[model samples]
Target: MEADKYVVVMNSEEQYSLWPADRAVPAGWAVQTEPNNKEDCLDYINRHWTDMTPASLRKG
Candidate 1:
């Protein structure tokens, strides 16, 4: 089969909530961004995940 292509951070689309960097992303995964709207919580990640990422981060 082909590889996965994205990661979904929530059980459902409704849970795309974003907490503060310290509270949300573990330690090193923090990327600064300003939320213009509610959609920022749901990040569209690439499929090329590596060990550098937190285990909690999904692989699609």
Candidate 2:
């Protein structure tokens, strides 16, 4: 059996999330990476998402 594929998605607030590759991306979210295994997608998020705070709340 093949493992499920996922994609890294980002919202307007800069929050990262994983979404199934076979499903339609929800409103207000866009794909950030190509379809890949769940684990890889998660790793990408961990490496890239250094800040947990939403973009609106962060003070520059």
Top-lDDT candidate index: 2
lDDT (10s digit) by residue, model 1, range 1-60: 322222233222222224443334434334334432323334432222223444455444
lDDT of 2 by residue, 1-45 (tens): 444999999998899999999989999999999999999999999
Per-model TM-score, in order, reads: 0.22, 0.90
Clashes of each: 2, 0
| Runs with alpha carbons beyond 4 Å of true place in candidate 2 | 1-3
Candidate 1 wrong stretches, greater than 4 Å: 1-24, 40-60
Return the lDDT, model 1, position 24. Answer: 47
- Candidate 2's displacement at residue 59, Å, is 4.4
Candidate 2 lands at a TM-score of 0.90
